[model samples]
Target: MEDLDTLVLRTALRWQATGLPVVLVTVARTWGSSPRPPGSLMAINGRGETVGSVSGGCIEDDLIHRIREGGVQAACATDTPAVLRYGISADEAHRFGLPCGGTVELVLEPVSSRSRLDELLQACLQRRSIERRLDLRTGQVELRDGRRDGVPRLDDTHLATCLGPQARLIVIGAGDLSRFLCQMALGLGFEVVVCDPREEHRASWELDGVVVSREMPDDLILRLRPDARTAVVALTHDPKLDDLALIDALQSDAFYVGAIGSRRNSAQRRERLHMHFDLPEAALQALHGPAGLYIGSKTPAEIALSIMAEVVAVKNGIRRPSPTPVVTGKSLHENPGYEVT
Candidate 1:
């Protein structure tokens, strides 16, 4: 799935190329409690069609209404962007579905040839992070290579927004668990790729919007050169497939490198990597063995959910608690309602 900002830009580019007027709305600032964060984007065409979002639903509705009524066109007539505020008052907040005392400031830019929507879209498609600067007075735009996540920067004259690479997830397996994990990752806006050299698994694998690779795991990992925005998860549980790929992933810039396995197996794998491969202890420490958070998951779906949750937490720079054993009194078949005493 494309990231929200990228989707918004692509939609705007399409509308503009079709000779339709488009307006790009960005959540420039927010206070108290806002559904969308700063730099969130929404694009609306002259025909009231919209893509992406800056708020829940109310803000988009209001924007659509304004577009239909020519309010937005009139505001952009001078070829200068306008800043609009919503939910300033209690009634307004409630009416707009904003939390109490919440406020959202938006920058509405009338899209045109000079908006460079196409250039921005190209950069994003090429997986290049960029910094986009918009002049508040002249509606001009400037694009540059960006190294960090984009944040909205508003001063007296210009607003600078960061547009970063879409997060990528490479699952080193094509199985039931991989299917669930890929789906969840897609819903989370990750460009997912599943790699399995085995023909039987590859033949049976069927999931939309995911790229399936028959390339060997280590070679695929090397070619991908996983960055900070990338995550690699090995669910095959086969050492020959999982270990080599994991070694390459750990040595790369990937923010998360995890493998699904039992605690004992995880330890044995680490020992082998150290003894035979001579992988450094620090790199081994970076590997997430027995991957997911401890949730006592017994099924593939639940395990996938736990792993994705952990990956998200790490991506958000949240420190997770150390893994713990799932405490249960007895097997589910023996004690369906088993509880730890």
Candidate 2:
């Protein structure tokens, strides 16, 4: 599934191409709590058809009603964007389904050729992070390259919003675990790709909305050139396939690089990476072995859930305590094959 921003932009562009009057609403600011973030987007056309959302149903309903009643048209008649605030009072909060003290401010821009929705969509599709500046007085827009995601910046004259590339997940296996992981990632708005060179594994694989690649893992990773928004997870458990891809991933900008294995296997994998591959200890430390949050997951689906949870936490820059149980070197020495399940 495409991210919400991409969906909103594509819908708006399609609506505009048909010569329909469309309005694009952006959540510019929020206070207390909000269902959507500051950069969230919503678009509505003259027929009251809508795509995307700025709030939990209530605000969208209100916007539709106002558009139908010409409230939005009156504001757009001057070809200038308008700022709308919701849930200012206790009663209004209740009506709009917001938390007691929650408030949200939106910038409503009438879609036009000057809005540059097409150009923005192109940039996003090309996987370029961009900053879009909207002039409050003239409704004109400017697009430029950006490196980070930021909350909407609104000043007296303009509102600048960041539009980043969609998050990507590269699962280095097309097994049962990969199927579950890919589906979950897709639901979480990740562009998923599964790579498996084994013909038997590739032949039986079947999943929608995911790209399946038969290329070598390391070659594929090099080609993908994973950015900070990308994640790499190896579920194959085969060192020949997982290790090389993980090495490439660790050398790249991928925010998450993990491999599924038992405790003993994870330790062995690390040693192999350091000794055979001559990878530095600091680089090897980035690999999440025995990947997942140690949730005692016994099923493939449960394991996938645990792995995705950790990936998301890292993506959000949240520091979490290691869930792996501590074991002494003497204990490992005594039981060479000891594994944590």
Best prediction by TM-score: 2
Runs with alpha carbons beyond 4 Å of true place in candidate 1? 75-77, 325-341
- Local accuracy of candidate 1 as per-residue lDDT tens digits, 151-269: 78987788899887888999999999899999999999999999999999999898989999999999999998998889999988788999989989989999999988766677788
Q: What is the C-alpha RMSD of each candidate to the true structure, in Å?
A: 3.7, 3.2
For candidate 2, write residues 1-341 as lDDT tens digits.
99888899999999889988889999999999888889999999988889999999999998888778884584366668989899999999999999879999999999999999999989887888999999999999999998647779988889999997899999998888899889999999999999999999999898989999999999999999999889999988788999989999999999899998777788899999999989999888888877777666777888888889899988888645465654663322112112433
- Number of colliding residue pairs in model 1: 1
TM-score of each: 0.92, 0.92
> lDDT: which candidate is best?
2
lDDT of 1 at 300: 78
lDDT of 1 at 111: 92
